[model samples]
Target: MTALTIRPLQPGETDLFLSYPFPRQPELWESQRDYVALLAAKAYRPEHTWVAIRDGVVVARACWWTGPEDKRPYSLDWLEAEPGPGQVELGTALLRKAHETMRNDEGRKPDYHLFLPPGWRDDAMVRVAAEARLQTARNVDLALFVERYSYRWSAEQDGLPDRSDRLEFRPADDAQMLVVLRQVLDGSLDAHDQRSVAEHGLDRAAELQLEGLYWFPSPRDWWQLAYTGSGELVGVIIPARNYDMPTIGYIGVVPSQRGHGYGAELLAEMAWRLNDHAPGEAVGADTDFSNVPMVKAFARTGFRITEEHLVLTDTAAGK
Candidate 1:
């Protein structure tokens, strides 16, 4: 057997990366065809894509995506291998090598995210394909950060949850909203929030969140501060647009405002706002499974789970 070689893709090699025969079992968000379509928009860069070649045939491939305004890759969305033996090891080496090259002296390595169909475990083919890539990440020193549920608000299927009139929403800029964002992090059960606060401190975590929300293509005026009728603070709701659809960029309640059934209401308001802006369009949302309240809020607000996400953060040095 020719020795395996792993490296990032060079210019004009998009087709080469997709040459691997990934079985078309279950439909996923990271479908190769869809990714190829996104390539025209520059959502992916060749330098950030990698493949493991054995005997001149692509056996493994990993694709990373950076935000529209980012210069470097942010997170990996696709990790796949041609169906056959030794594919797991091939995947592990490819990821390990690719991580080091992509980091390029940056302190943080890009994380990996997988969007699998709901109840994917019940399908033997999907189960095997997912586990193979997950095992590769574990082997390369990436830690499984969280399992999150991806939901969609369908106008026809989910209908619309009634918007409560209890809370008053006031338009606020980043400066005013910053304070509330910090307050909500006090006891956040969201896995990403917890990790950010712990590793980067509350101020940084809150700022990072604001940056993320700002990154969306949503309207600035849509950011509103939720308050009680008498002027007490409840939280914030930012109905925004992601790449493919409208979404609730954020719906957060301050620590003091917990347990008031505010989550469901806040979520409902977010959806209504989205509906007002993008009529007849679906709204996407995600919440870590650890965030029971958020999960409940999603369900209560008529958002149905369509996909399960497995998120892994890379802590390994680019050696």
Candidate 2:
């Protein structure tokens, strides 16, 4: 095996390092350069991007960011390495260099995360991660691709039943939207989400621009709350666009209101509203894979699993 020599990418090396992703079809350089430029524009430190250079050729590349504009601590993305005799070793070394650069040297280790595509789960690079002890965090980030959508378009996919005549469904303005957003996230979800919510409330979470990051049509509405004959927040669904598809961003029935099928009804109502208001593509959303109730609720309303995601975490050294 060839020895791996990984280090921080130097200035002016962008063109060369960016071209490494495409051994052939170097035309990809245009798109790749655009992406690198975007990251560089917002990077807290220019050295965040790293490259593994061996024998004067860049073999691996990983983009890194710290305390990016949003509340997100840091992120590493667009990681790719060439298929070479020492690619795995080179990639691991490059990753280690990144960790040390941010966490050790810069003291910026505020729980960074890497979202690896499922196809790379069993790669030698991932094996190095496990040996380094970066514990896999809670919740798989499942997704349903737009292409695999199998649910038939139905008119029944619109509006909630006025069963509990006392409750009303009205489009919410930004001010009225605050109330529904308050209870949007229940801190009881998972270790990761819980920690996040516990530290940063829903308002702060929203400020993270999760919705803005998604491609969705909006003028999002906080569907009127469901109250019984006696007014109370029984159920609520805040629907919006995710990748321009009808996305149920937040739907919850107070624990006291569960088991009476209110959760399912709220989801159904949201689906209908989205179909009616934003009648273009499809409706889709994601919940933790373990959230059987939420998953089942979507399924009952004609949504299906279209993609699987595995969330992996590893130590700085790839343990």
lDDT of 1 by residue, 37-72 (tens): 667666778888888988888888888887666788
Error of 2 at 277 (Å): 5.1
lDDT of 2 by residue, 1-319 (tens): 4556777766666676656753431212222335554655554344766777767777777665443344332555345566545445555666656665444322433343333323334666544442222221211111121111123233344323333334556555555455554454553343344545666876775444344323334554444566666666676667775432567766666666666767667767776676677665566666665666766666666665543333343323322
Candidate 1 runs further than 4 Å off? 104-106, 317-319
lDDT of each: 0.83, 0.51
The candidate scoring highest on lDDT is 1
**Which residue runs of candidate 2 sit more than 4 Å off their true CA positions?**
1-18, 21-49, 64-74, 84-87, 100-167, 170-187, 197-224, 228-230, 241-246, 276-278, 282-284, 313-319
The Cα RMSD in angstroms, rounded to one decimal, for candidate 2 relative to the true structure is: 8.2
